[model samples]
Target: MTTIDVKSRFEAKLLRPAKPGNDTSWAFVVLPRDASEQLPRRGRTTVEGTINGHHFQATLEPDGQLSHWLQVSGELLEAAGTAVGGMVTLELAPVKKEPEPDIPPDFQEALAATPEARKVWNTTTTIARVDWIHWITSAKQLKTRAKRIVDACDMLASGKKQVCCFDQSGYYSKAFRAPEAESF
Candidate 1:
């Protein structure tokens, strides 16, 4: 297993959301693997390879952490390495994320109390609610996290769950609407 020891800290920014239609839009600073080399490339062609079994395409940023796209078909096996005169296969390992907790009863009650909130909540998908709930609960502070929950609930009431403004082409487009609300 090849291990990459990065001594320096790096920051990666999302230049553009990765989507279909666009060939490439992401960018990152490219720094040297060795700290001895001071000269750094502001922008470099992203290295395309596999790590831990997942396919990754990342550009080197001025800082150390490589900004790359992680596409996983199966479990990631190993990290990238400098090899020559042989077949080089990227390895990928499983990325484990903490399981989401059940939705709070008070939160559900609040939504149930408000007509608009209920409408929005009814419109939002289970997956979208799960994502929102996970994001809100993940906050470090309870107050701030509660605020996020309120804010998300407001958005749902406003009818913008998983708000998709445009298609892959950056053009405003239509998508299938969520199922109709049930009637008593």
Candidate 2:
């Protein structure tokens, strides 16, 4: 598959916790607006990349301010032997094919228990399913995640085909503030 390769070094930083109970320790590297614009997609772009020599696959997401950024999970940081506030070199290339996201066990069970939801889930497109799974799994607290699962089942059972008010392409959460707003 053809890919667009970009190599750059960036300083990693932890975004402020989305909510009080959330883990703000998640690290990220911001891509310049020009570089982001050259990417294949505007919202979520599937990618295979290297971070400080550790190979990884991830979705590059927009930061809501027309810039793109990659979320550096704790696992990726550990594999790369890096830490928050550290500088890391990244080599990214857009992947033409993206494998399906694995559904969380709890979510899979919830869907199994609600056949109607599962039916609706089956009818949704892959991107829609991805958004739903991302929404449910992105929760930081167990309680929140559980609630999302329940909510998802309820929504799907009610024939809701897509997650409401979610910007799948934007940053980690819908609550993320733009850099300018964050400076205050």
Candidate 3:
């Protein structure tokens, strides 16, 4: 891990997203194990920094292999003057403040429909909300996601403050991993 309190700088080769038919601009990179260890936590972490000298903020996802991965967006790619297959230098640190998550419409609507759950969700801290979202989106199957939504609502309504027994790191659960890179 990079030295504490000092920004971590490293070079990473960009790669294609795991799925086919993705937009050309959608790419990703896996942070080296050592760099990932510099983070404050093993779970999903929000980071603010620059890629190729262009300012950007994004959340890094746990690779489930005890590493971290980042999805590169089009705007970020353009601003940084890089693309898939490009090796770019990055300087990163955990964002001091958590940014609002882009919640899925389905989850949003579910929260809206359940007054009790909405009450709990609204009162929960943003970090907790992030965890709730991570749990929902981590589902590999649509049916599992749907069930998680229902369960989330139920748990919240019952006054559960966090997702119980969830392996946010994906390390112990083996339920998540960095998506497979597409064939070059």
Candidate 4:
């Protein structure tokens, strides 16, 4: 596919979770696999796009099955004059420079306790930190998450710049996935 094809500009219908939880306010859409395959990577790729002419930026999370999904905030939906179940056009491309990923409190605390790791972390690229955060946070179990934090600290202290053996796309390990939304 051409670069333009990989950019994945297309239309999709907005959807909400069948049963709302803490995220009742958010709507979402899934990208077709073909469109997703055109992106730079399978993991979380930050993109700047317009939703029905309402400009916004977001990081597309891998859908565990080799595709990707995007969450549309209520504010964005309102700005775009779109709503859940509304069809919207999207024009997206990977951002030139990735913004820093939010560090979870537990991971931040762990880093604080390890001075060497904290120093290395401060020096790592924002994109690397993004992947590290994704790898650490994608763990399904609390114990797995805790272990990853400890391991991440050790690796960072040892001067590792990026996560090792992590499947960012979730296709190989099925470690990542799009959030569940209500089906039509």
User: What is the alpha-carbon lDDT for the whole of candidate 2?
Assistant: 0.72
Q: Tens digits of per-residue lDDT for model 4 on 1-184?
A: 1222227678898989676677677898999888788778888988887888777889999998988999888899898998998999988878878888899999999999999999999999997899999988888899999999999999999999899999888889887766677877
Residue-level error in angstroms, candidate 3, position 105: 1.9
Q: Model 4: C-alpha RMSD to truth?
A: 3.6
In model 3, which residue pairs have backbone atoms overlapping below 3 Å?
none
2 versus 4: better TM-score goes to: 4
lDDT of 3 by residue, 41-128 (tens): 7788998878887778789999998889998988888889988899999888988888878889999999999999999998888778
- Assess each prediction's global lDDT (C-alpha) against the native: 0.39, 0.72, 0.87, 0.87
Alpha-carbon RMSD, each predicted model: 18.0, 5.6, 3.4, 3.6
Q: What TM-score do all the candidates reach, one by one?
A: 0.34, 0.62, 0.88, 0.89
Candidate 1 lDDT, 66-167, residue by residue in tens: 221222221221232221121333332221222233677757766776678778766666545655654555456878777776776677778777533212
Model 2, 135: alpha-carbon shift in Å?
Answer: 1.5
Looking at model 2, the pairs that clash are none
The deviation in Å at residue 49 for candidate 4 is: 0.6
Model 1 TM-score (2 dp):
0.34
Worst 10 residues of 2 by lDDT: 175-184
